[model samples]
Target: MVMGYVSGAVVFLVGLLGGVGLGIACRQYWVEKRNRQTREQAASVIAEARKEAETIKKEAILQAKDTLFQMKAEFERESKESRKEFQNLEKRLLQKEENLDKKSEALDKRETTIGKREKLILQQEKEIGDKEKELDAIMDEQRRRLENLSGISSQEAKEMLIRMVENEARHEAALMVKKIETEARETSDKKAKNIIALAIQRYAGDYVAEKTVSVVNLPNEEMKGRIIGREGRNIRAIEASTGIDLIIDDTPEAVILSGYNPIRREVARVSLERLISDGRIHPARIEEIVEKVNLEVENSIREAGEQAAFDVGVHGIHPEIIKLLGKLKYRTSYAQNVLQHSREVAFLCGIMAAELGLNEKHAKRAGLLHDIGKAIDHEMEGPHAIIGADLAKRYGESHVIVHSIAAHHEDVPAEDILAILVQAADALSGARPGARKELLETYVRRLEDLERIASSFSGINKAYAIQAGRELRIIVESDMVSDSEVVLLSRDIAKKIESELSYPGQIKVTVIRETRAVEYAR
Candidate 1:
């Protein structure tokens, strides 16, 4: 059993070994087959990969060639467009060159045309110069021939003719001058009289007789004692306060206020009257009254001046000048109120200026201020006109106004129409009847002056001053005075009166030529 077991075991072992061998072989074979299959698969994959790479390479090459062809085509198209642009630019440049050549030719033609015009103008100028020279030569020749024919030179002949014509003109002018003078005198005299009459008629003014002293009428005799006070203290206080003298004299219930300054005198007068009325005349009361009166009088003076200016239609007077004008309210000239006189003069000046077509306001201003110097003439050394002019100059009055003031009184020569107008207005105001008070001697002398002036003429035989020296009636011999001579004689006498005599208003000279031929028929 052991041996058989051994043989079976051996066979089994051998068979197991063979099986193991076969299994090993089979495993090797399967492994080799799987390896071969894997290698084949790897080779196939490699071959396929190669085929795909070749295909891709071919496509890539095709694509690259197509891209190159497209690039070339695009380059060619761009080059074509660039070449076409260059061609167009070259054509434009050629056309610009052709246009430049045309403009250059046009410029050359315009230059030639301008050159021709300049030459023509220069030739014309030369021809005109030559003609002027030829004409001058001909004129010189003609002048010499004419001079030779006339025996005198042309210049001498012209002078001789001028003298002959002048002589004839002189004779005619002398006759014309006489006629013109006659007409002018007749017309001017009538016009002047008319203006003066108009001024007088238009102005309605009341004449106030000026007094040398301001008199304050008292209520009763007992009031005078109250003004004198104890030991004259009140009177002294009043005077000291007002700068005016209080003249308490035997004037019968009247106190005289006296001072060179009209303003001060006015203050003293009003103060005394108030003191007498109040029945309080102590030194303190007197000073208080005088102080009050001073302001009141000053205001009155200012108002009077302003009112006077307003009435005359004058404006823009200096405040100081207006104050001085107000002081004229208390002043007197030739027994006439200076303020009234100034107003009259202003009105007259305005009227005359309006008639003559002059500046009425300017004339009135000059007339109003003409006598302003008289306000302070009592304190001044020179003429009122000079004093007034100095005041106006100091106060910045216009040159014309200052000159007019200075010349109004003939203190200076009346240079302008304003000065002359002022003078005329002043005379008209003072010379009018009842305008100013005149002494008997002055009146008589004025009458004599009129007669003397009228008789001073050549043709007049007898001269008489009628109408209070306003009219001079002259009797001339019929043989000596023709109708024309009579008119001339009257004008001469009137002119002499104006130039020589200083009368207020104009004097009328009337010349009468009477012829009486009486035959005794008995």
Candidate 2:
């Protein structure tokens, strides 16, 4: 029974194994069939996609062909238009060339015509030249005949005509010159008088005449002996220290101080007076007093200069210049106080400058410094005007001011209106009556000399000194002195006076020539 059971079990196991294997085979077959179907479907889809790709490529190629054909046609059309434009440009160039050829031909013809005309003009010029030569010869013949008939050569006739014309012209020019000179003189005289009168009227300055000597009154005659000191040492010391001469003359209680230098004379005078008052007279005391008085006088001079400048409203003067200007206070020119005269000149210059519309301050400055040289004129050898100008220039004065100072006395040429104004003011200041004093005999002698010098001229009939000898009027015989000769005569007389006499300022020389015709009416 065990064996049969084991056999049946084995059979059952075998059947079970077979059944499992068959099911596995059936499943693998089904999977393979499904894979085959899937592959077939995939292959069919790929083939259909390939056919669509081929159809799209053919359509693209046909579109490319059509685009290329259109581009070619457009290129051909542009080429045709370019060719047509080229043909038109060629035709225009040909037409321009033909026109240029025609114009060149015309220019050639015009050149030929111009050449013919130039030849004709040259022939005409030659003919005119020959005709002119013939006319010149004819003119020469006629001139020779005329000259012979006139008994004078052509040159002589021309000279005579020229002389006649020149004489007439000279006479006319003389008349015109005289008329213009008369009118100018009238106008200038009136204007000058007005200006001078206004200047004199505007400023009136006090006149002080200065002298080279100063007289100091002493207490008694005994003071003179004491001043003279032992062995005359005191007076000698005073002279040595002060550069002045002390004259203790036999005058009553008066000591006369004498020096060419007014400033030194002043210092000496003051020092001696101080010594007399102090009653101490010796060389040492005399020197001390002189030194002190010199300082005082110098201070006074500076003050005077400053005062003059202040009065004139001028400032910025150098200290040394101011001191020199102060020295003028004691200086005298022809007995007129130089400082006073300078002040008067300053005022007059200022007034006249204002009237003439010039620089008033500059005028006043020039006037104030016009006589600065007078301070040191005794030491320096030159005209005071030139010395003053040099001082002003050295002290940094303006060129105009320097020139004005120099030309104030005509030492230099007056180059500007300010120079002329300074001259006029200086003249007015010194030339005024009583401004300067001279001996009466000297005055009469100067006038007589002026008249005599003027009368010495040949044509002068009479010579009269007028304006206090400032002017010499000479009457000339009309027959002897012509209108032109009077001018020469006046100049000669002026020159003679200048050489013969020494006078202050300038003297006017006037020559008068008059013609008189007497006719009786019955």
Candidate number of the best lDDT? 2
lDDT of 1 by residue, 1-522 (tens): 899999999999999999999999999999999999999999999999999999999999999999999999999999999999999999999999999999999999999999999999999999999999999999999999987887889788889999999998898688657656766887678668855643432232322113435789988888878777788887778878987677778889888776556677677777777777788678888777777877888798899999999988888889989988988888766567889999998888888889989999988988888889877776657767899999988887899999999998677898888889999899878767677556456778888878877776676788898887878888998997898787777767776776566554456778889999989987
Root-mean-square deviation (CA) per prediction: 26.1, 24.3
Q: Mind giving the per-residue lDDT tens digits that candidate 2 earns over 294-413?
A: 898889999999999999999999999999988888766656788999999999999999999988999999999999987887577777789999999999999999999999867778
Off by over 4 Å in 1: 1-212, 379-381, 439-470, 473-522
TM-score of 2: 0.46
Show where candidate 2 strays beyond 4 Å: 1-210, 439-522
Model 1: how far is 301 from its true place, Å? 0.8
Candidate 2 least-lDDT 10 residues: 201-210
- For model 1, the local distance difference test gives 0.82
Per-model TM against the reference: 0.48, 0.46
